[model samples]
Target: MVDYATARMNMVESQLRTNKVTDQRVLEAFETIPRERFVPDHLRSLAYVDEDLRLKDDRYLVEPMVQARLMDVADIRAEDVVLVVGAGSGYACAILATIAATVVGLESDPELAKLAESALQEQGVDNAVVIQGEMNKGYPKQGPYDVILLNGAVAEVPKALTDQLSPKGGRLATVVRSDSGPGKGTVFERWEKAVGRRTLFDANTPVLPGFHKQPGFVF
Candidate 1:
């Protein structure tokens, strides 16, 4: 059996801390959340590895380094309401719940959504809820979130999701993949009348489903 606690500590010290993930809260959340429970039984041992854990279909629980960096960039506050797209089995939601006041995890896969909800509830993550929905559309019922996190990479940030930002300085963090270059871990913050973007680091997370760029018609 894998010593999950030791694995979490090793991941925190080796993967996250060494990579500049300095936020104490973010680090503690990663260490506290039972990452193995969020993955399939066969993948449980690999949960603390420094790579994305594929859940089902194209879904993944992003690597610890990437998720930590993004959470640090998001700078989630205790009073903030967060929305996590492609929430998969709810690892990200559980992490966010540690910092944010409320969390909404949107997942398109019914099975994954159920798994997320069940796992979160089992873990007593009462402030977070998992809901089934189109990943790209986002859950508008709890609109204008203080923070938005995409659980995987995307060719481009969807307008639908951006439109859900709090507008009062809400921030969205994700890995933006490029065809010509490496994917960039980026943060987009809503500014007065506009949204500004900044790249924090290079990331290569697998693109979440429905986020690929649509092909254009040939002339």
Candidate 2:
């Protein structure tokens, strides 16, 4: 049988550390989380692979390096409340739960939300709460989060999501499309009265459905 623990450690060292994922806390969370448990039973064997794993329908699991990079960018804290948008299968949420005080995992797909809830519960992750809702609409009831992490790529960061930040208390990290070429990893942090958004790294990821631009109306 393949040693999953060893694979996880190797992934952290080879894929994450080499790619600039230097946050020790984030690396530790990645190494400890049982990634296979968050994936479908049939695809568990490919859990530690360097490629994105396709789940049911058009949704997909983000690559390990991509996820690790985003978490490092967020720089989660023990006292922070995090909101995980597009929380697929609770893998990212599980990672956030390890560092943050609380995690709100919002998913639009009912089945996926249920799967995430079950996965987190099975892992005894008590700091996360799973909720089903429209992917484009940010979860406001649990608002004032210390950090917001979008699990999928999008053309732009929604204002609704940004408005949920706790004053200058948090930041939002996501995969946003660049004006040219492929998408770029971006981070938005509240600064005084303004929100400063910047692209961190070039990335290629499947765009989340709800964040797509609407088609122009015919004349």
Candidate 3:
């Protein structure tokens, strides 16, 4: 049997620490959560590896290090309400549940939403509510959330999602494309009623389908 506990420890020490995920709470959440359970049965053994795990369709579960870094940038708090766009299989939701007071996981794919609901229930994570909806719209009824996490890379940050953030509250961390290249991850924070966005790191992952930029006619 693969030792999940040992693997979790190694993941923290080797993958997260080396990549600058220095938050203690973030590290603890990553250490305790069983990432293997979130992946497909055939790919369970590869869970702890430092690579993005592809799902049934084009969606992907971001790598552990990437997630940890995103979580660190968000600075999740116990009293915070979180909105997770593109919940995937609920791995990121599960992790956020450990640190945030409440979480609303929105997944556009019905199949993935069902899977995520089942997985979260199996893990006894009651703090998170899973819903099937449009990723760009976000879960507005649950706003104003303290944090919003985008599960996959997007070319642009949707206005609807950012509108749900609490006033002078938290941040939104996501992998956004840059004009310079294909896959670039950017972190955006909302403070003092103004939004500040910046590129944090480079990540090559499949972009979420609906978030792609619309084409325009060439002159």
Query: Against the true structure, whose TM-score is highest?
Result: 1
Each model's lDDT: 0.93, 0.89, 0.87
Candidate 1 achieves a global lDDT of: 0.93
| Model 1 Cα RMSD, 1 decimal | 0.8
lDDT of 1 by residue, 86-164 (tens): 9899999999999989999999999999999999998999999998989999999998999999999999998898899
What's the TM-score of every candidate structure?
0.98, 0.96, 0.95
For each predicted model, how many residue pairs clash, with residues at least 3 apart or on different chains? 0, 0, 0
Q: For every candidate structure, what is the RMSD over all alpha carbons to the true structure, in angstroms?
A: 0.8, 1.4, 1.5
Displacement of residue 200 (Cα, Å) in model 3 is: 1.7
> What value does the lDDT take at residue 129 in candidate 2?
89
Q: Which ten residues in a row have the lowest lDDT in candidate 3?
A: 177-186
Q: Pick the candidate with the highest lDDT.
A: 1
Instruction: Using lDDT as the measure, name the better of candidate 2 and candidate 3.
Output: 2
Q: Cα deviation of 57 in candidate 2 (Å)?
A: 1.3
Please write out the lDDT profile of model 2 over residues 81-167, one tens digit for every residue. 999999989999999999999999999999999999999999999989899998788899998888999998988888888888878
Ranking by lDDT: 1, 2, 3
